[model samples]
Target: MNRLTLISLQVLVAVVVLVFWHIASTTTLIGNPKTISFFFAEPLAVGKRMVQWFMEGSIWYHLGITLTEAALAFIIGSLGGVIIGFWFARKPLLAAVFDPYVKAANALPRVVLAPIFALWLGLGIWSKVALGVTLVFFIVFFNVYQGVKEVSPAVLSNARMLGMNERQLLRHVYMPSALSWMFSSLHTSVGFAVVGAVVGEYLGSAAGLGYLIHEAESVFDVTGVFAGMFVLMGFVILVDWLVTLVENRLLVWRPKTSVISNR
Candidate 1:
């Protein structure tokens, strides 16, 4: 389907869901809808709250904190992940030695780690950044590792026969070959980065959209909760778009797949 058609379908689905939600909440037909917080803020109420925030200036401050944490996490985590992945992939023995340890670290509950990070970094933006980094690192690491390992033995043999040095082979063969997989993980990392930052903030920060949502929940401000969630989603979408742009630039050598019938 075309973009327009997809957009129209999404809108229609959203509207239908909203209408059903409003009717169920406003009337007693569905039983005690007031018992749950979800029923309190219908689509219109959430939209109004979102508009109010847009009208006011508080949104920027929260948004800025969230964005900063996410960007930092994305950069630091991606860098660490790529380095570790490359190192381990090149040295299978070392990778084997650390495999269980790495799995253990990845298995640990990240939410539990948030409090420790908060203690180490303090109840500030850095705490959230650190939390987000942990969430993002493993994802990129595994993808890059797998991508590097997937390089064909025949390709390596050909490059070696052509007298390619270790450095030259890595630059021309492994790195370029892994670039697509790296970016694929990076796209997912972006979303995890946001979640880590927000959840960390919700657990204990004084600022950030997550904190706002936490505060709103404490006061039973369903509209505020929805507004914060919507804003976080918008930010994630923006970052994802930016990642796609970068991917397009870097992977310019790759051929585009035919999509529309006209092509």
Candidate 2:
């Protein structure tokens, strides 16, 4: 679809959802309106609460903390994932040796690690960053590894015949091959980075959007809870938009037959 058409469809979907939500929460559409409102909160009320939060400026500090944790996690986790993925893909024996261990690590439930991270790092941003890194690392690592492994054999042979050394091949061939895959996971990585930060904050923290939600939940303030969630969704969308701009710039030459990204 064209950009305008796609956006129009998206807006239509949002309107439908909001209308349904308003009917369910503010009127006797689904069942008792009071009970529904208690559970879900009126959409208008939540929107107003969101506006109040931004107007009062209390959310900026918490937003900043969450942003800091996510930024650190995305940077650290992506770097580690790319470097390690390259190493493993280039070294079969090394990969074989660590394959099971890597699988085991990835299989572990990340939510289970939140409290442990908090205990080890204290109830601070670092704990949140650590959790976020765990969430981001596996995604980028698998993509990068597959991108390198899927490099065309014919291209490799030609490069080898042209007298390129391993280091030169890696710089010119492997890195470029992996770039598309790396960028393809940008949105997912950004979302998970935010998730990790928020989950960590929700579990235990002095500040963050997640903390705001948790506080609201404790008081049975459904409007506040929904407002906090809406803020988080907007925050994530903003970050994803920035990531997309970077990806579009870097992959301006992405080809139709590129094996690096499914796109």
Candidate 3:
């Protein structure tokens, strides 16, 4: 489908869902109306709470805090991943020495590290950023490692025959391949970055959307919780779209597939 048609359908689907949700919560269209409304909260109520939050202007501070944490984590984790991944891929001996340790670290449940991070970094944004970094780093690292290692041997030989130095080979061949892989994992890493921040906040924090949701949940305010969730979803979608734009721009030479009209 065309872009406009796709967007229209997406909006229509959301409208239909909201309408059904309203009906189910307001009437006996599904389970017990009281239970449904109590558990899910009315979509209208969630929207109202979201509006109130925006109008109160307190949410901006929380948004800033969360975004800062996520942004820092993304940049740091990505850089570390790219550097280490390239190093390991280039020096198989070094990789062999650390391979088991790296795998073990990656295998560890990041949630367990939250308490340690909190102890070290305190309950401030740094703790959350640390958590997010751990989550994002491994993703980019693995992708880059695989990308560099998978470079075509024939192409590498050709470059060597052409007298390309190590740096030249990296710039022209390895970088392009690794970048493609790194970008592929970045979209996923963004969500994990957000999750790390939010989960850290959820575990312990005085501010952030996660804190807001936790507070609402503590008070049994389902509407507030849902509003916080919707806000988080909205931000994630916006960030993901920004990533897509950057990816498209940077990978312009990556080639594109043609789309022919069905009609």
- Candidate 1 lDDT over 1-263, as tens digits, reads 99999999999998898888777766677767675436367666788888888799888899999889988998899899889999999999999999999999999989999999999999999999999899889988998898789888899899999999999999988987676677756677888999899999999989999999999999988888887888888888888899778877876776666211112
Q: What is the lDDT of candidate 2?
A: 0.91
Every model's TM-score = 0.89, 0.92, 0.93
Q: Order the numbered candidates by lDDT, best leading.
A: 2, 3, 1
Better of 1 and 3 by TM-score: 3
lDDT of 1: 0.85
Question: Among all windows of ten consecutive residues in candidate 2, which has the lowest summed lDDT?
Answer: 254-263
Q: List the residue pairs that clash in candidate 1.
A: none
lDDT of 3 by residue, 1-263 (tens): 89999999999999999999999999987888789988999999999999998999999888889999999999999999999999999999999999999999999999999999999999999999999999999999999999999999999999999999999999999999898888866678888889999999999999998888999999999999999999999999999999878877876776465101100
Give the range of the ten consecutive residues with the poorest summed lDDT in model 3. Answer: 254-263
Clashes of each: 0, 0, 0
Report residue 126 deviation for candidate 1 (angstroms). 1.0
The segments of candidate 2 whose C-alpha lies over 4 angstroms from its true place after superposition are: 1-6, 256-263
For residue 32, give model 2's deviation from the true position in Å.
1.9
lDDT, candidate 2, at 213: 95
Error of 3 at 42 (Å): 0.8
- Residue 199 CA error for candidate 1 (Å)? 0.7
* All candidates: CA RMSD (Å): 3.4, 2.1, 3.3
